[model samples]
Target: MAQNDTFNALLLQEGDPRPIAEVSTLNPADLPAGEVLVAVEHSGLNYKDAMILNGLGRLVREYPHVPGIDLAGTVTESSDARYRPGDHVLLTGWHVGERYWGGFAEYARVHGDWLTPMPDTLDARGAMIVGTAGFTAMLAIEALEHGEITPGTGEILVTGASGGVGNLAIALLAALGYRVVAATGRPENARHLEALGARSIVPRGELAERPDRPLLSERWAGVIDSVGGDTLAHALAETQARGVVAACGLAGGAGLTTTVIPFLLRGIRLQGIDSVQYPATDRERVWQRIGDLLPTEVLERCLAKEVGLSQLPQRAEALLAGQIRGRVLVTPTDH
Candidate 1:
């Protein structure tokens, strides 16, 4: 496509009480200043994308914005030595969706430093399937491993188990020989979670409520918690001695009303994971590891649906309501 040719994009415009999301057309010249131009093949729907889609969280300070947090595609132009035309690339973090134009468009222009050369093991579609959610999951697991947690230590608990990060975490941990226990509010998805490599399922009620006591019976050797609030408090209370908990998201709320007894008595370690703005130097290595570790079948199974740019508004509502089960891919050009 020529630089002046129009392409479809999901545009968020300022509105009465919230932002209005719509499908609009734009030329490459309309994109913000950047070093690399990419033809976005696929972008992933994430929690933050949902917030931006509906104008929640005050994530976007400007109108007429694109709101996809991560994407995979091939470069069409570059002004930087680190990238060249036709090179496959993927991007996540660096606040592209929030503070800048992102992959909700058929094309995106971004800083060369914000892009990772796509691994050969993954094509555009496959890379987006393992998008930001999987990227964060890998980071969480790396933290667990760095804390000396191993498969033989005991069961690894994944909270928000039916969501994107939790689902991928179970699959990755199981593939690495760790027994994974999935925790979710929807009991109906137990079979699905188990199929994704969860050895067992725990009801969300088991951990969602605030801990009545400062400590509980030791269970998980490690935890990949996407849900904060009471779920985190409960998880911390029950973590085994020297256990590690990788805190990634706040789908369950951001408050922490627990005591430090878990950290003091059992030596539990709570590590916060920041996928956004995570060093670009380490991204390519992590993406390669995700490609090497997560099986193709598992990755494919984790995909919940694919929607065009026009469908994002309603899908965003579903996602924020906790109705989305796994990863959702966005086809920017389809609309």
Candidate 2:
């Protein structure tokens, strides 16, 4: 780590109106003190990453920051016994992009405990395509399974179907022999969702609009909802008896205007997904599951586009505005 050696990173500097992201050069020596240093190859853009990138939410506590919540690459240096130079690893959650120096750079240093060995079958780019969104999708499916909702039990409704989590959830659930119906705002992506194994598509507005009754006609056997607020409420009300809804994101809104009748009378359950603090053991298990479930074809279809660090700012704005589809991967070394 010489002072003369430089790497590229998307540095966020404080500005009057909003934080700005600029591609800048940096020294590895300037990276925060950590046991393992990774040569980041690919990182994914999520809603949280967009929030951090645009300075919309108070996600980044410090300026001159990097904001990629998920990354996969090779370890260049490690003092921990669990990892060593040349080891392929991936990191998600643990507040890397929010509070700590993150992965939107050519290099990242993090505690060894936060690093998970990359899946043997997936390359760096493929692993990052799955990213935090896909990881959370897997966790949500695991939660549904834990709740005893089997594939044959009933049809699963996936809200925000055109997004990363929703799309991955559809593909994974379909791979597991479940009947899935995708709910999305983009009708143009109906065929895409169908190709991912969705049996049907429902307009997002249908669910986003508040329902008149606390309980609606029972339709879904279960739901994997990424858009919270009214959509989540509608799903809860429409879920069949003993059904489970795995609630992960709040892309639509955070406020929930629903009653407990869905829970008390219908025996439905709403499980919250927290990928940030998932146990290391379970993290390994889920990552392995994602590796097994997500095939190369499915992964390729979910890719919206591959970008470099320099393109992150515009992509971040598009992501926040709901103008992008699927997953966007950032290649740190792109020229």
Candidate 3:
């Protein structure tokens, strides 16, 4: 807000391959070109964000990149007809963090097409806490529901239950009266999962390998999977007849090996959940449902910790080691 006085941010330089998330300043004139410029209030940490920070995956694709994939704030300037100054908005996906400067900085310039109104039900901080991970959770749940998943069907399994998407999915499904069994690699996270309404919690090693049989005991009616390796294959194998497992992340491994027995014979469905570049109508619907289904206190409790942008290095490592639980919020511009 002052001349030559820059705002602090965590910058990821490509050549360095190491994150230097110190107190850095940014000038408004240097902001990337976009239809709307927002003063970001809050940002959320995700597994992908960790990847960007750690340079483990080829996500950022650029040097000195700001690696937040989700943000919520109010518009400070708008050149597009869809938004104006003083409007509250939020954004996720659509290559904003990867290809363009993201919300890790105090100000974010994003394309008008990538922005959505911040629903009255949520403010800037709440929006960041829900962020991209929670949105994907709702999307996975929606996919399962569209495929006829219901409370009456049977128990629903949520893999990587300690992560942001998994945590929110467990809470949402449980709130809707579905029996939710959360799967986590960290046995220490069991209590947190239970507090989030997970009916049961199990160790991740149980689903680490390919199933001995093409089909095992039918357990879940639906699943929200954030891990994509043999765990997904195992969940598919263990799913009940005609059950669905929405596979999203590749935390364990990306490769899935399984036979058609679960599909052709048992009528199992492995639904893929993609959050990036979804149709606007579908995105709006998911947000509306998230507003209706996710309670405030639950969302509040879901946040495990809050950190400044400078703390991202340690945060990223913790997430990779599965040493953290619940959601982590990055207050890019606030104290």
* TM-score, every prediction: 0.98, 0.98, 0.95
Candidate 1 runs further than 4 Å off? none
Tens digits of per-residue lDDT for model 1, 257-285: 99999999999999999999899888999
Instruction: Give Cα distance to truth, residue 311, candidate 2, Å.
Output: 0.6
Alpha-carbon runs more than 4 Å astray in model 2: 1-3
lDDT of 2 by residue, 1-335 (tens): 45588999988998756797799989977788889999999999998998887788687778878778999999988899999899999999899988888899999999998999988778898898899999999989988999899998999999999998998899889999999999999999999999999999999988988789999999998999999999999999999999999999999999999999999998998999999999988777788888888888899999998999988889988988888889999899993
Backbone clashes in model 1: 0
lDDT of 3 by residue, 50-124 (tens): 887777767766677777889888898889999998999989999778888888878888899999888877788
**N/CA/C clash count, model 2:** 0
Worst 10 residues of 3 by lDDT: 14-23
The clash numbers for all candidates, in the given order, read 0, 0, 0
Q: Which candidate should be chosen as best, given lDDT against the real structure?
A: 1
- Candidate 3 backbone collisions, by pair: none
Task: Compare candidates 1 and 3 on lDDT and give the better one.
Answer: 1
